[model samples]
Target: MDLRVAAAVSLLLALATTTGAVTFNATNTATGTIGGLRFDVAVGLDYANLVLSNASAFIWSSAFNQTRPADRKPVDAVTLVVAADVSGAAAFTAADVITLSAPYVGNYSGDVRTEVTGVLFHETTHVWQWDGQGHANGGLVEGVADFVRLKAGYAPAHWVKPGQGDRWDQGYDVTARFLDYCDSLKPGFVALLNAKMEDGYTDDFFAGILGKGVQQLWQDYKANYDA
Candidate 1:
């Protein structure tokens, strides 16, 4: 074997090992009807790792613009738990742990697998994204997470179309759509914005990035649709 070929193979293996180093775990705490739906922790863990790896890359490119592990959150493990008593189909994340309502899993009218995958992507974003030291708007935080979900191709059927939001920070799909517009105006807009949010958040972030206030940008976004 050529020395160059051997060195290339060694580099690839090291990269793969590093990428796969993050650990994922899943648990199901539901019983009865919900538990009967067969929560596969093994499969869920595999998918979570895949989504986490991919999301980190996409968000790094789209928001953080850094690929080094040191540039990311220091978390080395993430756990996905299924809970029976949570209200609504809503999911939440705390630190490195994500909890999905088992009720939502059992009651989902469509493909549960795809729905869960999307939920994992959104929740996993919460695990990795910086929060402006808890000073950023909650709407923007959720929107950024959903932005990852949107980029990952897991956007649900009911998401609002582009240029359809009432405000730039209305949050979730609305804010995600608006952020998407902002990114269109300048590539890596989200990445630069997220970097700014690391210390704290300001409305000026919009002006700093695009030379326009968020409100004016929102107006332009809505106007584009009106045209």
Candidate 2:
């Protein structure tokens, strides 16, 4: 290899190492059906791995600011399985494993690759996020994942708009929108909350960070964006 090229490669590898080099393994285990076949056609294992790398970079640098390994999950690898029979959900992550519903891929009417990329971002967040040692609010947890997807510019059109949900912790897009609002009030608010949840979670953390209770913040968020 040319010396310049080798030096560039070394630098990239060094950066990745500093941020924690987590292996991403992606495979389609549902190739018995057309849904799985569609995954192979629209998004092969190679692209899935790329999304994993991209999502990790985005979560650390842009969304969550978890640039250090100690600030995020310590897993050494994350696996993504594109499989069928995963009904009633587009994708979900358990521990360091992400399962994408091949059936959803086949049935989706939009850009399959783009949708999968967005789903990958959401699921990847689950793998890296601090979960309050399994005691965090489930809705807030899901919302944070969706917030990453939202920040990635992949929020679907059918999602509820700002201030549309009945509660701040309504989960998914609702809570994601609320979090976006919170981030606006205090830059890096989501990142702060995420770092706080490294070991435990409390609604009171809102007061510590923003000088207001979570409920009061929610009310202000609603009033600010309600149409």
Candidate 3:
């Protein structure tokens, strides 16, 4: 996808937030699949059902597409909604619903049946991810989501390049791109960072990865932007 188009999609989703409690059908069975990968979607609900269910799972699949087998199921059953215009995107505040753009679905050359599955992985991580009890940096929150997407090999073609964009924690694709740099220099770096976030988040967490603070990571990331 073109960067502009991807950015538009991201922005649309960002505005797609709702402020109501989520309701589920006790008998409501949902199945989710992406690029042909499937999984049990309801296993990790209620932990933070709003964040852990569908949204997080979709993002998770996107980030870790390469980590799963082609026939593997990522979630048991969730309604996969492919919207030509993201109309149903905002209808969900609870992460329990899997939503994807129509163009995104059509862009996959892989067996991935739907983009919603991939996007779920990223959102699912948010549900399960510890945010230092809301003290975590938003950029890192988004970056980690993309990090999962990067690791999963679903990163869009436009995401391959690095940059001295806004700030390191600029969130979403920008932060994800920087996280990719850290991962390149330090194997398992993203994993370690995720572990750290699980317990609690701190700026010093970067020290654990690069022997420097996150600010330093940002600087280093920018320095190598063109390399």
Candidate 4:
């Protein structure tokens, strides 16, 4: 993986992934490489688009609890790129685009489609979720995205067990586990918090949603699982 040159991009006229005005596109630049070949064999463009479309619907319905369009960031299209590069990670989303590391795809030993779909669920949350107008905690932002993935039933077995994080906003699976606990106390808790974040983020949002600060909730969350 010395250098990644953009492959001939095709604006895939997606299947039924598009709803009304929104469109989804994908391009596999590494199709000639081993990793890219695996991606095509395990997860093709049609399947990837399906995951992206279904993930978006899942986040809107479950993660946001059907929050109105005003609460959402308006992105009419999303593009996913499978590149011939070693990102040292699975995948990442910047704005409306998702980049999957072809090297990772090539090396996957198990259900690659499921794994990639799970990664899409998490990254798709980033595309839709607010970042507190760039005023939110990075950990919380990532945690919320992971929480969405968790709810989507895509949380990998390697994820930390519930109540195992060192802090409530520990980010990723750790914070995602904490958020799950908070959601249990008050259903739709995450949706409310995300709504509040549309303007800005504050720890007080926890108090407003669950009548307790995040720290106390985190402790209680841990105590429940301490067997």
The candidate that wins on lDDT is: 2
Ranking by TM-score: 2, 4, 1, 3
Give stretches of model 4 more than 4 Å off. 1-20
In terms of TM-score, how similar is model 4 to the real structure? 0.89
TM-score, one value per model: 0.85, 0.91, 0.54, 0.89
For model 2, how does the per-residue alpha-carbon lDDT over 58-168 read when each residue is reduced to its tens digit?
A: 787778776666666778998999888799999888899999999999999988888898899899999988988778899999999999999888889899999888888
lDDT of each candidate versus the true structure: 0.74, 0.85, 0.51, 0.81
Candidate 1 local lDDT, residue 138? 95
Can you write out model 3's per-residue Cα lDDT over 106-140, one digit (the tens) per residue? 44455332233346546545544456656788888
Error of 2 at 38 (Å): 0.8
lDDT of 4 at 168: 84
Looking at model 1, which ten-residue stretch has the lowest summed lDDT?
Answer: 1-10
Residue pairs in steric clash, candidate 2?
Answer: none
Candidate 1 ranges beyond 4 A from true positions: 1-16, 19-21, 35-38, 41-45, 61-63
In candidate 3, position 81 carries an lDDT of: 43
lDDT of 4 by residue, 139-225 (tens): 999999999888877788899998686888779999998899899999999988988888887888999889988788887898999
Clash list (residue pairs), candidate 1:
63-191
lDDT head-to-head 1 vs 3, winner: 1
CA error at residue 184 for candidate 1, angstroms: 0.6
Instruction: Name the weakest run of 10 consecutive residues (lDDT summed) in model 2.
Output: 1-10
